[model samples]
Target: MELFFKYLQYEKRFSPHTITSYQTDLHQFQEYLQEVYQLEDLKVADHAIIRSWVVTLVQKELDSRTIHRKIASLRSYYRFLVQRGLLETNPTLRIKAPKLAKKLPAFIPEDAFTQLLDQSEFTTDFKGQRERLILELLYGTGMRLAELTTLQLEDINLAASTLKVLGKGNKERILPLNASLINALSHYLQLRSATFPNNNSSFLFVTDKEAPLYPKYVYRVVKKYISTVSTANKNSPHVLRHSFATHLLNRGADLGAIKDLLGHASLAATQVYTHNSIEKLKAIFEKAHPKA
Candidate 1:
């Protein structure tokens, strides 16, 4: 497990959050195996044992997507072990991931985001300015929360109105910034300078003490503001990202362009936003079409 973790960290260059999730999934499976079957070694485990673990997970009422992720983690681990010659056969090769219903990504209403920015009262202090900028950047740039947290001062090009993002799998992409986002970032930079006069932090967003912004702080900030504007089922930073992409698609932005903006590895990943757009089109058609 340690060797696999090192592989993910250095060789694969996965983000810390992803590495942590892999660890948690593996640990949970190992615990289940120990508790139920007294199995201390995965080398002796077969496909039947793995299938039973999946059944146990389903019995625990875990979501299909989550169960699929856990199974994927096991498959990766076993594959790694096989490559290293430690395992004779991969136990997860035949185990199929449960079929999941196609669910559209939940995004904030476009006007709702506008209302929050225009009507909401934010403090004039540094903290308030920084928090507001964080929201703007997330929705404006459509960058992932992890990408936002790792944003550095050097990544911003104010004159060009672009932000260079380090995305999943350590892929780099440039996202153009809108006028509103640029102005907000300018105000935040001024406030940041005043708040931390002697600070030399390279990271773009920082805490009150000038430390780098962690994932939890970003989540809290997004949730606090988004809850006021939306009653979305999931109110996280990714919701803002989803809003960003959905809004673009509705406004006639090209799908391939959106795929690039979102830093999706393939067009299929970006095509999901089309589902939401189609739903909106259905609503418009029902309202406008004369046929009852």
Candidate 2:
């Protein structure tokens, strides 16, 4: 377990937030094993015991996604143990994760997106500028909120109209920016610099005190802006991301290119946006059909 955490820290180069999630998930599994199976050492755990634990998770009515993640955590730990010769075999080798249903992502309409942007521009304060930029980047570049929050001053190149985004698993991807967004970011940077001349914080977005913006702050900004323009069931940064991808897909963007732009590891991951686009097409067909 310690070696696995060290690998996450040094080799995998996982962020502190990701490392913490892995730790919490693993610790929960460990506690379950200790209490139910009286097993203190992971090396002695067997396939049957792991299967039983999965059964308990299902019985608790945990979502397939969460259960799948827990299983993944165990699989990784067992793989590490096997590679290091700490265990003779991986017990999770044949354990199957529950099948997860792919739910379509919710996104706001184009008119609503425009409305949200218009509402966000109502203020001339620093917070207002930052909030507007947050919405623009999410809808413009389709970046994850965490990626946006961690952006550094050097990550953006206005001249090239691109952003150097560090995504999940510490992977780097270059996302394009339009002239309008580039102009907004440039103006924000100037204000940010003038407000804190001696500040050395590398984050692109900062508070009035010049500290880096927290994830919750970004979430709140997204939620506030979305609430004004969208009456959709879901309103969040991820919805904006979905809207960005779905809009691109609707406009005939290649699935592979969208995958690369979103920094998704596989084509399957990016294919979810296609589902949203298909639904939109179905709605249009239903509304336009002449014969009943």
The candidate that wins on lDDT is: 1
Number of colliding residue pairs in model 1: 0
Candidate 1 residue pairs in clash (backbone atoms < 3 Å): none
Candidate 1 per-residue lDDT, tens place, 88-151, comes to: 8899998988899778899999999999899878899998888889889999989999999999
Model 1's C-alpha root-mean-square deviation from the true structure amounts to 2.0
* Candidate 1 off by > 4 Å: 279-292
Model 2, residue pairs in steric clash: none
lDDT for model 1: 0.91
Q: After aligning candidate 1 to the native by TM-score, how far in Å is the CA of 8 from where it should be?
A: 1.4
lDDT of 2 at 281: 77
How does candidate 2 score on lDDT? Answer: 0.86
